[model samples]
Target: MESIGTSQIKKAIHHISESVFVGLCRKVGTSQMVAMKRDVVDILEMVEYYVKTSDYYIVMLSGSCREGFRLKESDIDSMFWPNNYRVIWDLSQSHYYNTQRQTLILCDCSDSPPGFTLLYLLSPSINRGILEACIRMKNSCYISSSKYRQKICSLSSSNETEHGPCVSGAYGTLEYDNAHCLSCDFWPPSASSWIERCHSWPQPHIVDDIVNNGCHFVAIGHKLGRHEDHEWRISFSLAEQKLVYAMNHCQFLTYCLLKLFLTEIINNGLDEDDKLLCSYHMKTVVFWVIQQNTLPHWRPLNLLGCFWVCFKLVLKWVYEGVCPNFFIPDNNMFLSKIHGYKQRQLFMRLYGLYEKGLAFLLQIPSIRSYIINVLHNPKVSICTDEHTLISEAEFDETLYNEIHCFDVLYKSDIQTCMRYLHTIEQMIGSPLLTQYQVIMLQILTASLLKDTALILRMETFTCKNKLKYRADKISCHMLKVAAKFGFITDMLFIAMYYFETRRYRDALSITEMIKGKLAQPYLMYESKVDTKMYTEAVGGQSWCTKMRKAVAWDIRLYSGIHYISELVSEQQSALRKKKTILYIPSFILLYMLEVLCYRHVDTMRVQTALDDLQTLVHYDQGQLIDLRHRDISWQILGICQQLTGNHQTALY
Candidate 1:
């Protein structure tokens, strides 16, 4: 078979995007969304009633249902926050006995006669009671194994196991409105500290908002013998719901399309027993892709490109046989499954689909109909004209919304820019640029202004330097405006500016915040033993090491003379062996930062700077370092030795 060409793939993606929008929009119409919300409220009430009688305080909707990306068959995932906390102790005693005829009788808790033999394994009896209460609640809510079997029988013919527990663990499904069903998973209140755990996550301030807003972890079902049948899955469902809810119409449509493809296309091709990938994986891939890229990349016209990117990400994960859990970096969602031959099979299947492109999708009758309907439907129209006045207005709004009030800073009249900036300050709830947004803004401003003084002023504002602030109030206003955005680089620049101005304590505080964010990924990576095993195999080292180095460099640079010992202690952990083949520019920058930092304080230890420069030269074979920096490093080394009264060593 001829492989799909690039143009053909693009065409297919365009059709797929249109069909997905029409199909999902129709399914999730105003009435359907209202019904979903109503169903969720009802489910919450039912759960609240059950938990109200117990120690649990609140029950909230979570997962796809809350995230507003649910399909026709998607389950409603929910968790209840427990008020009382109890510690569990494992009594590793076996819960089995031999039959009278010497036959091995495996006592199973989930069996017809629910065995209490394993009750010995549970401690304090309170946890056991809680689990039992949760099970009873599931049965009472009409989501028990028996209830599920009945529903299956009523709906369709299926020969699958009818006596097993729900895959989601203590989750129950109920018919919401005859046309839709709701599935909810109950969880015990998290014992873990969200503030401590999420300190290092990307965008610490946003994470702070999430934690303050009541996001918590939950104990979820894992493989039966793993971790004593208990594993805490960090639940970011609330945060995710907020993110998806805030997504523009186009981004949401793209997400729906990806989910649809996973369900209708990918799942259909896989064997019933294959659990290599699922819709959750698809959602995670999209979430990370969004975080790594800018908002403009996900525009409506770029819908096809976004979907293609999502598809490629999924394909990459399948091929690698690993998918890191989004919230918990160490938790490999596919750890127990997708290994060796199974992984190869999944890769081949996905690759084959990729190769076949739209031709394979067209072969599916339902999909073909969707495509045809999307193409001809009067209600669904793809606007291709960009020259219209409406289009221009929309374009301007798009730029305004994404670029935020900062767009006004680039106006032809400087006074007008300042006025708009002042207006934005007075306005409540103005959009603030993220770190990535600031970078883009910087580039845009530079490209448009073409004025070096203005650009330097912008940089000085970003740095938040007090030294230049007295010179101009405009620069001070710009600094305040940039501070509102709170970009990561902004903080770094501010810290550096403080350090340069000898405000050591203030610089240390900002550097600590940067350290906290950078350290989060490392802490997450270190928490899971499996992460280290798959680190290199899955391309984690590249990103992980870079983040570690950032933290290391920040500590070494801005930590001040008082905290130098801490930096020295963290050196080995922070600075891993560099990859010989890949030249990381950050490594060089880190060395330079270190050299500059050491020269500013503690001249006696300037030897450390010289050593770092030497290591950098050796690692990249001097290709990255300037000859001037190398000579300066040597001079610094000699000066430090002389200052330490080692004249002979300094001369040598």
Candidate 2:
């Protein structure tokens, strides 16, 4: 019998993995999903009616439900915003308050201003009023306010209200038709600051988009006994919803696999009281993992790989007893649950399953047979088809359109940032510009500058000469600004810009500087999860480490460096030999850069690129990289091979 080739083995693994994911999705069942959606709509309608009749203005459905990754048992999480009152931050006192309450009560303390009040007023009377109003609603539902309050009190030993055991805010359950239920929390509009606080996140543009729209902040009770702090908990549910919505078919299916793993396997055998993990936690892990990876890393065939990445993240969190909130790092979502002995138990259970690999995943009750069939009999047809896979032409077209949009968006954002900077310069001495605002302006400006440099590098080979020259000048200035702001990723682009412009010495110098910086330990200055910040401080370091492993791994960076080094060596040899060197035109230099990039486009090179990308995809378990750039790398390699008469290999 002939032995199977390596590529065939990979293809087989890919097919089997996809089949398993499809089976899991099938087990999830469309009927249950339909039921969940109908129930959610009905609940939302009811809430909308209540808000319309009452002082509340709107009801926002949030959490897993809004994120489109909900399970059958997942509770509907929502926020109610009042219409008559405007929530405002009281600078005089370090708490939030409603503007209307200022005139209702008077305080004469020296430190406290007379026209200030606590926001929401979580007193016994207020709690009772809200609870009574819910009970009076026409919907015949079971009220679990008492049980929720008791649970909150048990979680925290803070002062309780006279009406009942109270936490930081009120909690009530509205059961509908004995088949569905919604858990609602009321919060003041001022709590939106929690979302605003994520402005310092690495992806400033995405955070800006979230802020520009609206972010919800919920009133979650204190985990510990810290009562003086009534800070509202920020929820990125809206941003998450948008992110999940933008996911391609493959990513959505991968998410389903994760939910199934959490619900059917992890939570299945455990007693109700012993279950610490939930679908929400799994979703949070997925969000962080997605932020760290690129699109190619999340292909449909790699669904199991993505699931494993999320699992490892959760396992690490369990071991550390700390699952940092995706948006707010300071808020440890797992602080209360995975403590002491429980952490050890949780870690062991997950680790054991992880060691068992596909066999363990097959143990999931609902899809056990489907997974077994896919694994044992490779010939079996897996229901999950490759419909999500895009043709080469489609992929190229999509890439072109996306890059075009990115070019326009980055240019527009850069102009806006400059205008803001100019405005700040005009207001330099004015009291209106606070320290925080100044810092924010600097951050936003730095981020936009980095983006500008990145966009310029991406377009260097494609754009016209005049535009390329303009991009070069702007990129140099932007790189200096980014350096001043201590953004290292922008510096990496600076090196690439120098290379593209034929400044080999300068490019090499910048690369060396980046390497030195990458050697140092990274520290988190702010308690927010920003992708750019993480990439610059930590992710960049990891990338450098990976690049140093093999020149073939990051062909774009390392190969360019190698070519520059060789060019410099040849020039020095000519000087030593006393030979007159002919000057090359700028266009010739650019052509040389392109040739060097595509010169080694053999079958081995193409395979090496794919293997390197796959290795990088698996490295760090679930961290995200710029996969779009990786995609471009493959395209360049293919085009180079095609030009050099390796048309068949290039087509492959």
Which candidate has the highest lDDT of all?
2
User: Which ranges of candidate 1 are over 4 A from the true structure?
Assistant: 1-19, 30-57, 86-206, 213-230, 269-272, 358-367, 373-652
lDDT of 1 by residue, 520-633 (tens): 432221112123323323232232233223212111121111112223322332233221111113234334334445556655544665566556555644433433335434
Compare the candidates by TM-score and give the number of the best one. Answer: 2
TM-score of each: 0.40, 0.42
Can you tell me which runs of candidate 2 are displaced by over 4 Å?
A: 1-9, 24-57, 89-209, 217-219, 228-232, 383-652
TM-score between candidate 2 and the true structure: 0.42
Residue pairs in collision within model 1: 200-520
What number of backbone clashes does candidate 1 have, counting pairs of residues 3 or more apart or in separate chains?
Answer: 1
